[model samples]
Target: MGRKVTVRDKILETAATLFYNQGYVQTGINQIVAEADIAIGSLYKHFKSKNDLLYSYLEQEDIRFFTTVEEKLAQKKTPREKLMAYIDFRIDQQKTGNCTGCHFIKINAEIGRTDDEVQQLVQKHKEKQKNLIKKLVTEIQPSKNNFDAKQLTEMIFTMIEGGVVAATINGNTRSLEDIKKLADKLI
Candidate 1:
């Protein structure tokens, strides 16, 4: 039998959908309460404020993103293969339109700098991603190394993020494909 969803789950699900699809500032607490089918007091019980909810949503995304990445990377044996797998996973996500671009970026663009907590969460999420990529870069063989690991990490990270932004704006994955090629050349 399936487990029942908690009031917290309902609130988070509703808020995540609304925040990602609609801008964070545009999605009101009332809408989340109504869509979640929960009482106003219930939301407050789980989250102190809308900002608190946004932080929870971002934290959730961070965990989900890395879990998926770990699963994808595990399928590959070598570090190079693992890095390529990550890029390919990103490309597939964009191609399938399974996501509406990166939620972290979308939320950050909406209100990251204004909210110190959100800003820190975004920074932490990005740093975690960069560090993971850097680890993969450092593990690759010397023959494949075209640039220093640090430089390569920055390039690959920038390419992945820039490609996502371009693909999101153009409604196509061409930029992502190009990014994959460029990354393939560098590493």
Candidate 2:
């Protein structure tokens, strides 16, 4: 029998978990290959380089993370509920041990805005999320007051990033709860 065709995706999945949990700088291709139980050539076959694998991993995280969220958020009837659902989902995710500060932001810092495909993917993911926050804010409040909407959205996203980092580093889930309260106030 020949090797399974799922090797590439399996490798990418392992790479994403490792790269995000441990900084990209701290993860090496050899480690990914070991964790993935795939040959070195298998990784190289799918991605041209470690950067390419990291780029693909970030994109996958974006798709999986937001798709899961938008799916859950859709179940809520009101935008207000949906917005709160987003915060609640983050807290719930922390409880499940999936917490790692925003993967894009963490990778972006580790990579330091390098002119590489991975960094570009990271920027795109962040911009997409920021835009989503803006959209959700507009939907929830339908504000004629542009300043309030803008400030609230910015503060909420900021608090979210802070909460994620705190949860991952200190295991302090109170930050997530505190941020949700602050988000309610800002909104």
Candidate 3:
């Protein structure tokens, strides 16, 4: 017989969906176990508390974002092309029926109550996004204000994040189209 997966894993998966769809505070541990069809004790066995589960969710999401970016980047021919693919990928995510708001934004709002691990994870993820934009900017604009590429990369990041927020709020995709246009101007 195949080995059964642990109940803790099941609870975390259910908890992640709940936390993602419903806000973190709005989703309770009881709700997670009930939805997971597992005993309440199962979660505590794996995670020290709800905070542990929340941190794990944030980590998983950060991994998902970069992993998707890498997979998409590999198919393109140049850094510039890969960068366009990055914007198109965001467009695809905006079109996804499940996208609420960017998970990082939501998680950022909750960091006041979160542990250092998750807060650090958020900080690290933000740095990665900035760096990715910096790499793309390097390919297009070799000359810049500083070695860090902060100003230009940050401008692009704002446009990208703004598109996600607008899409979530209005439930319309015009913002993504606008972003693509703006990116064309940037490049």
- Angstrom error of the Cα, residue 109, model 3: value is 2.5
lDDT of 2: 0.81
TM-score of each: 0.94, 0.86, 0.86
Candidate 2 lDDT by residue in tens digits, 27-62: 998999999998999989999998788778887888
Global lDDT for candidate 1?
0.88
Cα-based lDDT for every prediction? 0.88, 0.81, 0.79
Where does the lowest 10-residue lDDT sum fall in candidate 2?
142-151
Model 3, span 48-163: residue lDDT tens: 88888888888878888999999999999877788778888887887884447777777777665346776788788888987998898877773424434456678778888888
What number of clashing residue pairs does each candidate have, in the order they appear? 0, 0, 0
| Superposed model 2: Cα runs more than 4 Å off | 1-5, 142-147
Q: For candidate 1, what is the TM-score?
A: 0.94
Off by over 4 Å in 1: 142-146
Which of the two, 2 or 3, has more lDDT?
Answer: 2
Best by the lDDT measure: 1
Give the runs in model 3 whose Cα sits over 4 Å from its true position.
1-6, 111-116, 142-149
Tell me which of candidates 1 and 3 scores higher on TM-score. Answer: 1
Q: Which number leads on TM-score?
A: 1
Q: Put down candidate 1 lDDT per residue, 71-172, tens digits, no spaces.
A: 999999999899889998888878776446888889888885888998899999999989988999889843565578899999999999999888888888
